[model samples]
Target: MTASWTVSQMPDCTDKTVLITGANSGLGFEATKAFASNGATVIMACRSTERGRRAAIEIRDSIADTGATLNVRQCDLASLESIDAFTTGVERDYDRIDILCNNAGVMAIPRQETEDGFEKQLGVNHLGHFALTGKLLDLLLENDSPSRIVTHSSGAHEMGEIDFDDLHRERSYGKWEAYGQSKLANLLFAYELQRRLEAANVTDTLSVACHPGYAATNLQYRGPEEAGSRLRLGLMKAINAIVGQSAAKGSLPLLYAATARDVQGGDYYGPDGVGNMRGGPEQQSSSEASYDRQAAAKLWERSEELTGTTFTFVLD
Candidate 1:
């Protein structure tokens, strides 16, 4: 896991198609920029079309090669309808998908519901990507080349415990707890998907999970800004400046998981330095709870029920 890897070491991505959620900003933007720079047609699936297009334009200008295409499209992970439309467009236009980065997520925001009446963090971070991956499963499996589905997790997963009885946090909800649950679900889903893919004897699509450690990005500020707590926001900014790595550095684990040939299915990667706060991407262990088979199975079923999205693998 520690072979001194970086995005620049990524092999040529000619003819590859990479779809990234939240691609207009932060870590997603870094992912998009790298993939496009390396010749992959990067689809910027963002919630905001205007911002997505603007980012595409900026990235287009930054890259020297004109063959790297950027498609700006709207895909709101908070809304199922938006996700469906986004997938429909991809299916209509693209024949194969080389990589799908489930990178969009919400952090520790106040208790809320998505368009489908699920917890804000769980719905957007886990359920929405869960559904999108399922909807596009066939396209990914059909690809002749190796493909990957990289789910973004966090170190907070160590503190997370799935409460199935109140998964939606209908009875009680804490901001940090909810966020932890969602991030934990990310790993659970990633590992479980890999298991299923292998069991079905599918070799082309690999599902992996990774954490950013501690990165300073706009994501860190959204929660505080939404709560209108300038004090907390200021404190977060100060801490990030002192400790957080740049968004590009934070996105390394994601890119590594997505493109690295050494990466294996079901592998969980993160920073190797102290506290796993910030460092190079490396294979690392996640929380013990993240590896629970029974919980992952139950959560998978629950996710299918909640999202009405069931994965039909291409093992045949």
Candidate 2:
């Protein structure tokens, strides 16, 4: 019988460098805090320096240890320029990134495009991470020990359909639809990356995906706020109170994916409860669409075209 997985089982990560995006709050913050508590050198990458600094301070206080090191870097996923600069600084400072968690994202919202003119949700949630991961691939492979690229997708992917003809929703847009598309794209990118990495005979790098499974966080409010739907927001709040798990509870899957000793590449994890939306972490399968290799490759090609970021690592 499989035993329950818990954060208490997280392996010691002393001196390991773990970088988490959107670490300013919610699940990201919880993940960062847990990593630090377990002795990992944490990089809290956020779009806002003010918020990042504040978050780092809070984690430091919580861990209350002189050995816990937290670095805050400014990276705006909406702008490739910002991502480039941020990676440049990271490469200059750190020789290798043991764990790179693509955890930051934008949820459903008004039809707004990013600085690069892609839909807001797609740009920040998918393309931006695509660019960052491409830039950091070398650093990940450079490490002598095993490395991990953990992508944060969502359960909403079940409702997602990749409309290649309208990835940016240029033809039309619905808030949840856009969010679902991006979330689906996240899984596609993650699984495809793992496949490519394995095909290259590359060892030491594992690409994993995870979802929070109905956790309550600020991410949920983005859509309702953008659409000015008070009733929706109130309903969401009530549902969260009634059924949604805490942010820390929701973060279990991500933390488990990041730190588990037995985790394998391409593994997808989330809540084990009903609908896979509320419970402890467990390895689970994503939607059937997420397994479409042809669609995944197609999405990869489009991502390269749109973001101008290509995975250049040799698959030899």
TM-score of each: 0.98, 0.97
- Model 1 clash pairs are none
Error of 1 at 282 (Å): 0.6
Model 1 C-alpha lDDT per residue in residues 89-173, reported as the tens digit of each score: 9999999899999999999998889998999999999999999999999889988889999999999988888999999999998
After the best TM-score superposition of candidate 2, give how far the Cα of residue 158 lies from its true spot, in angstroms.
Answer: 0.6
**Pairs in steric clash, model 2:** none
The alpha-carbon lDDT assigned to residue 139 of candidate 1 equals: 86
RMSD from true fold, candidate 1 = 1.1
RMSD value for candidate 2? 1.5
Winning model by lDDT = 1
List residue ranges in candidate 2 displaced over 4 A: 1-4
Give the distance in Å from residue 291's predicted Cα in candidate 1 to where it truly belongs. Answer: 0.5
